[model samples]
Target chain A: MNFDMILAAAARLDGHARHTPLLSSPFLDQIAGRRVLIKPECLQHTGSFKFRGAWSAISALAPEVRDCGVIAFSSGNHAQGVALAAKAHGIPSVIVMPADAPALKIENTRALGAEVVLYDRATQDRDEIGESLAVERGLTLIKPFDNPFVIAGQGTIGLEIAADAADLGVTQAELLVCCGGGGLTSGIALACATRAPGLRVRPVEPEGFDDVARSLISGKIETNAALSGNICDAIITPHPGEITFPIMKSRCGPGLTVSEDQALQAMAQAFLRLKIVAEPGGAVALAAALYRGDALEGDTVIAVVSGGNVDPAMFTRALATL
Target chain B: MNFDMILAAAARLDGHARHTPLLSSPFLDQIAGRRVLIKPECLQHTGSFKFRGAWSAISALAPEVRDCGVIAFSSGNHAQGVALAAKAHGIPSVIVMPADAPALKIENTRALGAEVVLYDRATQDRDEIGESLAVERGLTLIKPFDNPFVIAGQGTIGLEIAADAADLGVTQAELLVCCGGGGLTSGIALACATRAPGLRVRPVEPEGFDDVARSLISGKIETNAALSGNICDAIITPHPGEITFPIMKSRCGPGLTVSEDQALQAMAQAFLRLKIVAEPGGAVALAAALYRGDALEGDTVIAVVSGGNVDPAMFTRALATL
Candidate 1:
């Protein structure tokens, strides 16, 4: 991946996506024993970094393709991101959500002027359905992680973080991000590598779906059958995407795995201490930072709180468990 | 009261207190039938607008007075605010909290390095204890609302909103601020009246705590009996303070009240649409805008979400009730 492409995407999205604040927490600093910065993507439009990718991808489409609109298969943040971005570009968007996806996400996507299509994950393949719709309607398909425009779009977060870190007198630091399809981790790694060459990028995954870590260990693509075990719904992917895997392999540092309990604890901590509600998936990087003390030791680390589109029921249950 | 004083406070708190973002919500705008800007003090340090006041007040204290320490009485945001502000300034601070205060608030105040002295609200006089502590320890009493410094500090939020609104092409707007002891509402009113004279400042109160509104109508400090009710804990004030009443009466335009149900509904809406966790008290102004439709017509409005420190149990219960 060329850094220039990501920089061009950032330039195109200059005033579109929010330059989300690089929030500093003295409490987090005390815990890490080093300066800690939080890139609050939870504050981003559609409550995730997915908006960056969706906007970049949709905006870069040809006029004819844009006229035909776009289709995406996501059950959470990416769904809302595409819905909102497509609306902003005056394009029709259809989001294929799992039958049991959070009601808030479904409602929010529809509210953002997207057509909501529900599918039972156990009985039907969402990707096949999305592709069929795309072909039948002559619409563009915006993959959540595999698209280059998406990666370049999410890379803008890293640019913001690098600029902020420099402003805060932090030239070098450890950056922790949650890995699912690896879009955010890879994008952030590429940006950090080019902008702050000395910065170390660590990608963390939940224990049950540690494909990225396993793939790194085995030096190839890895797969897992247990996609929806104890891991949070947003990060419970079976494997990394083909497009994202190469970026993760080349740019990301060693990957780490955190337990479900740790992620829940981190979610509670974010809510209680930071007074911000971070969905379970969004809190994984923070969980790794807090529980994986040895890995983060003596490093000025940045934890990407990727999103906050948590279901109220799930939030209450997590709070109870915590 | 001076524009320069507010500007100076803003400058002093440039990095000390969060320059909390003015979040725009199309969902809120559609529901309220006007452009809605949310000043998320829920994202502020110590989880409330109290942080701004406490930080500004403490930062401007004479060096000798700061060294002598400070005392405050509260079982809510102010207690945490004073504790954190004092800790930030390296000054010893004492807080008088009710014995049955939320465990989170008590823990947070102690965590911020304040000495917590528990008092029984039903049987003991908190003011007596606070005054005694101030006299015995030779500490300055940092009154939560009945202080000019605190009001001036709180005014900085208004200054920020005015500047942000102007940048957003808003010349005049209705500012809905939740009224507790009226420190925040009064401060905002003063700042808006001075800086953005065309701005309309509206104070919102919970149904049972309409002292500010009543005082506005009666043209005097109207006292209300301390009645037990199903109101949010943070803004369940019995009456407005002496210092804040006059400013609110003179500068504030009108006051409105919403039912507990409305507050709960608004809180849920904030969670679902804005993706921000807003405690019932913090959601009151937005509740007024959402429910008091005819009262807030034909104007762009800014609602100040003053805090987000609700106990997890209370938050769940509030949502369940809704």
Candidate 2:
């Protein structure tokens, strides 16, 4: 958890990563009972924050490794991120996606000039296929999470938040970020600890998949039933990665969880009040803030709106539920 | 039109306007056969470019008039814009909206702290109601388009585009802007005429509402049976306003028309490629550039994405169609 490495990674990605707008909403501030700021990573290239880590990881590879290309297994955003990053580096990459993945994401991965291989999640193993492909082709497997470079890349967001908070006259505050495999939270916590040491970094997760929160409380890795039927397909059902859970537990602030309904409400609020389209996963952090009203009291909060690549159909359905 | 007045309005809105990001899309560029620069006004306050005009119009009022408050009739965005602008000035306001207006928009307008008066568009005259409301309350009526202040306010976007274009090394280009009552096109054309004379300013209309183009050719106001089933509820059906027609005729480049299918495709492309949510009307100009390839040849072209307030249902339907 060296902050200098994160800063160095930020320097390497100076022009590559978008300095996404830090959007402020007077309406959200009024509702949240505190000053609130939103970091819109949904507007990032490839429509997610994953691009930062993917680009950083791809760019950091040795010339020979880069030439040999890369492989990764992801259901959505990370697939697009890796695909686009590999294309940018002139590396031929193959992404193994679940057969049930959204068609738009599959098309986007292909559109970014990457090879897509679909694997049945129920009948076949995605990781095994990815590993075999990487090994056979002498290609590097870029893990979506659990990679130090990936963590450093995601930390760039924390750097931006720290600088932006300072500019907004915010000295200390709580930072809420959605958690999947804990990469985003772990990376962001590391950066916040280094840049704004007093700032609290909280990982917000879906109620059904609160493994990270449970793990944090027990001081050990925990598993939860693989949750389904959650509208936020992006972060609803993932277990914390082995490498990321420890870092997240050691460096991150208290973990929180919110129901699916709360996430829907937050997503709707974002659409109606902020006039920005945020995917369900993107709204989870805000959901936690809205749900944990008393917990967030007296704290100026920043919510990481992690991505905005929601399918139009899913977005409308989520809004209807709200 | 007085360029000085427009420039003054621009100056007044210097920091007030969002100075929305002019996003370049390599994906769209590859598809459209030309570089595409999108001015994302959908991300503007009130979810439309109407915010600029509304704010400018409200801000330009004399202190006495400001004290009196403001009134307006709109089906959607303009209502919210006036409501928000009046709130910013600490003036009470009333918005007269059709009874059948979108529920989200009506609620949003009221939430912005405006008094919303519902009227029957089929049986009663909205303008008459608005005028009476204004007269009875001593409130100023902020016309949706047909006003000098409003046009100048909308012109600020053109100023922003000019500055952005200079940074991108783009000069002498086609500027395609969506046209409803022609306020945005007239204002943008006037601004470009003064600021970048070589720029060709084209007003794009829905296939069903080519009134501005027809009027420009005939040298007189013309009316047509409003088309049915336009996806862009905000602008697809409005006839050109009297004040805007002359300016549009004199300053605008050749007006262009795009089909409903084309508009939906454009919206889809914007969401998929640029990761921005654009309402149908907001994407009409971009649709013209993308679908009317032969018509928009030459130097770099910019399309004004007028707004991003599509109903979630409409967006889903549009995406499904695409």
Candidate 3:
């Protein structure tokens, strides 16, 4: 919610979250026609940036509340992140996930000591089930993006990007973030607004799931017609969060959207040039940087690869693009 | 070749080289049945730790010599590293590569402004061509592993591991390194000997290409029966380095070898759990950590993923294992 809170969250995440590398390649630079630097949060705990928010929210809770247990609803990445963070603190966690989510996510969450409750995405409401379960078990609900602590936690990434940009002698650049519910985008926008004012934040999403991009231009929260069918399953949200929309409206630049094909291509490029595996959702921002260069400005562009919890079949499909 | 030179290499690489991350995963720990820590040098520049040695060898040269250029011969990773390092210094570079090497590496080497000369691995002598080219062009020859400066450069990784281990409260562990001509293993072994005395470095290689392992047991340099045909082309050297073997024999622990299947499985595990790409050669150490655990020790084990310039087809095959 604020810079001090972000700094506080950064302190709580110390030793728990990975300080991921800011990577670059000449091949990537040539393709983007600019200096492209990447902050790969896929290397974060639980293979996503969600762990930062999960840790920030869970750690800030009172001992009694946290001990009572925590619960969250996620398609995949956030489920594993919260599961791992709760397991680390020796607390019980309940995760409500869509039944069709990647099998790896379901198994990993359970492996991390979480009770995974799967529900039909088309027929059942995950939030309703999660809330009822939380009430019955005295579990604290940790939302993916709307929560202040979660935003502050994700904001820590902006702090890192700002520091790295300055270290690399980059005072100005467009910081592109993969947008789902806009938690990551808003948090980073807030951080850069204060720390590296010269750097602008932009949200990127899959073509049909470009609610954030639409919302930014309309100056109001916009909703997507469909969410579940996209290849970028990790970032397909119905709409931007209430808390996140205003931050993007005020502090972020116009949003960008990339096709599923571009996302797949970006994943292959990431594999070949950067030696990093990026899930489709995680590759969207990079996709924009690489394929949508005509609309972008700046001598240097920083893109955040937000997650890498992709299934192998999908990964192989992405690799096929190469 | 020594700790001081490694320290000096680190100094020169302070801003130039990526201070690659030391990653860990509960999934990897569960598989290895021990606390598994990964130093993913695959995330290093040019998709391998070879860049460290290349930069070290090139940067330490006198200004006049460095300005003229550098030359190196390799299967792939070292060629790219040397090419990129030379390009960064605005110096011309000549890379002699195997005619059958990965097409990606050959194209990348040429793309990085290096004149790549392809030679037949079965008949042509690479050293003679490299030496002749260096002599004719007034270029300093940067051997992949045999040179003292190159060893010192690769040893910088050991210094990093020592510092990271100390920070994480790990004083003693088996540091598994993917062995090529023993450059990385020896460099890390020598660094750990002085900096983190409790940590023991072990060389890991693919089966049939385990010359470093056999040489360590015999207390003398040993040669592999075959020179090519392995999928792990990046690390299939004929023999241990003349300079590196003595240091590895003196300072490192007993060597370990893993089957190609295990390497492929480890590559999948790295993709699934660690979210980093690992070439089969790079995955051998990780393979040893996971499948060859019976031969390892310590409460914690560190595996260095040495390179990740894998072809898409091979990467797809690795993913199929998941």
> What lDDT tens digits, residue by residue, belong to model 3 across residues A251-296?
9978999999999999999999999989999999999999999989
List, residue by residue over A208-306, the lDDT tens digit for candidate 2: 788888889988888878767676778864578887888887888578888878888887777765656678878889877666767774568889989
Please give the ranking of all candidate structures by lDDT, highest first, separated by commas: 3, 1, 2
How far off is residue A55 in model 3, in Å?
0.3
TM-scores for the candidates: 0.93, 0.87, 0.98
Q: How well is each residue in B178-213 modelled by candidate 3, as lDDT tens digits? A: 998988998888888999999889999888888988
Candidate 1, residues B51-146: lDDT per residue as tens digits? 888887888888998898988888788988899889989999999889997787787789888999999878999889988889898888888887
Q: Candidate 1 docking category?
A: acceptable
For candidate 2, what is the total of clashing residue pairs?
1
Pairs with backbone N, CA or C atoms under 3 Å apart (clashes), candidate 2: B42-B308
Task: Specify the highest-TM-score model's number.
Answer: 3
Candidate 2, residue A229: lDDT = 68
lDDT by residue for model 2 (B212-315), tens:
77887888877757755677667854578888888887888678889888888998887766667788888899999888888886757899889878777766
Checking candidate 1 for backbone clashes, the offending pairs are: none
| Two-chain DockQ for model 1 | 0.45
Superposed by TM-score, candidate 3 places the C-alpha of residue A19 at a distance from the truth, in angstroms, of: 0.4
Model 3: runs farther than 4 Å from truth? Answer: A99-102, A120-125, B99-102, B119-125
